[model samples]
Target: MEKQFTLRKNEDFKRVYKKSKHYYNRDFTVLVKNNGVNRPRIGFSISKKVGKAHQRNKLKRRLRSIVYNNYRYINNVDIIIIPKKHTTDFTYDKLKSSLGHVLNKAFKEKKINYVK
Candidate 1:
């Protein structure tokens, strides 16, 4: 994703984690908050338990690509994605499906609308 659509600051992450609710699944944990911006912002977190630096970086790249490609379905929210240890066990398609499912669930629960 572009820098403009990315959640970069520590304070931004803390605010979302502290104030918003999250969706948890076997692959990932998604923390979401309405940012009131025209576009959504996203951040990714991969713990050491998941992998080393190279593996973590690769996972982040994959996630960024997935989110960027599906940006149309994302609304004006701040989404923080924390991958679980077993995330890498899945293929890219599986990961993408899980992420999409989680996001769709959150959007429905929060009554947020996104462009199809």
Candidate 2:
């Protein structure tokens, strides 16, 4: 499937991290912000704290798969899924379950009448 969204730049990440509200549930952190578009774009952040470059990239690929699998149902806010320090040992099933629960919760907590 196509990458329906683009990752945010370091500057954009800083701006949103400062201004946007967030939620955390052990597995990931979801940051939501209105991009004034019809559909929201999503991004992921896997820091060096997670592991070495190999481990970090592996987790990044895993998280991207989670988002790609459900791209159609989710869209209109910039979302950044951060893999936690504990996620380095994540199994496929574990990651899937975590992504499903957290992604849904992020949307659930979002304002229903948000402007594009």
Model 1 over residues 1-116: C-alpha lDDT tens digits? 67999999999999998998888877788999999999999998778999888888888888888888877666778999998988876778888888877777788865644322
C-alpha RMSD (angstroms) for model 1? 2.2
lDDT of 2 by residue, 29-91 (tens): 878776666665777788888889999888888877766767666555677777789998989
Q: What TM-score do all the candidates reach, one by one?
A: 0.90, 0.82
- Candidate 2: give the clashing pairs: 39-76, 40-76, 40-77
Indicate the TM-score of model 1.
0.90
Give the number of the best model, judged by lDDT: 1
C-alpha local distance difference test of each model: 0.83, 0.72
Q: Clash totals for all models, in order? A: 0, 3
